[model samples]
Target: MSAPTLAPYVFKRPWLRNLLNPLANWYANAAGYRKLGLRADDLISEENAVVAQALKRLPMKENYDRVFRLRRAMQCSITHKLLPKSEWTKPEEDVPYLGPLIAEIEAEAKERAQLDTLTVVKNH
Candidate 1:
């Protein structure tokens, strides 16, 4: 069978919303893969573009948690930079190694959160 054509009303269908929720950002980001680069600029460009596409597609999905996860991902990326893998194990207890991009992500996350809140209010 074909995948259902997406529409705003699709979100009102509980089963459809449940199935699509967790996979929304993941599916978007998984599109267009490329090899990682040794240079920092190349990596940043690739990663940011993937994230931008995922974020752009977020609003079209049928799930709230997908939006929440994306918001949290943006917040975490802003608050925490590329620390060693060991740091991920103790993230809650450890201080994040902040990077220059933190402010931008934080601002974007804040804006998205406000928009989400408004969406929820409208749906009520």
Candidate 2:
């Protein structure tokens, strides 16, 4: 299971969120993946079974786009070149497409485990 995140706690406070939002954006931009046309979610490692299942559930078009993005990013990396500005992923376009599905899958798995281990009490 993933460790708990402080993000929601910080996000709940308007003052903290306002203070952190710019820093978060700056960090994301400075990370440089968007310059290669990859979204932040695209940076997630795909080798895990949960992620694999989540990937399989993606719409065909998004699945195709994801593969294309990864290949293009790899090629750019090998060539030591970034995509042209127009091709770079814009902030608004860099949304999490796979994260929700992965989280859903993990939640379902957790629920299934809970059900499997459930004990029923008999009332006669």
lDDT by candidate, in order shown: 0.41, 0.92
Q: Per-candidate TM vs. native? A: 0.21, 0.93
Error of 2 at 100 (Å): 0.6
Instruction: Compose the digit string of candidate 2's lDDT tens values, residues 1-124.
Output: 4547898899789999999889988998899999999998898888889988999999999999999999999999999999999999988998899988988999999999999999999999
TM-score of the candidate numbered 2? Answer: 0.93
Please give the RMSD to the true structure for each candidate, in Å.
16.2, 1.2
What are the per-residue Cα lDDT tens digits for candidate 1 across 4-69? 457467688989888876685354334311111011111233245434543444435422533443
**Candidate of highest TM-score:** 2
Model 2 superposed RMSD (Cα): 1.2
Clashing pairs in model 1, backbone N/Cα/C closer than 3 A? none
lDDT of 1 at 87: 25
> Model 2 off-target regions past 4 Å?
none
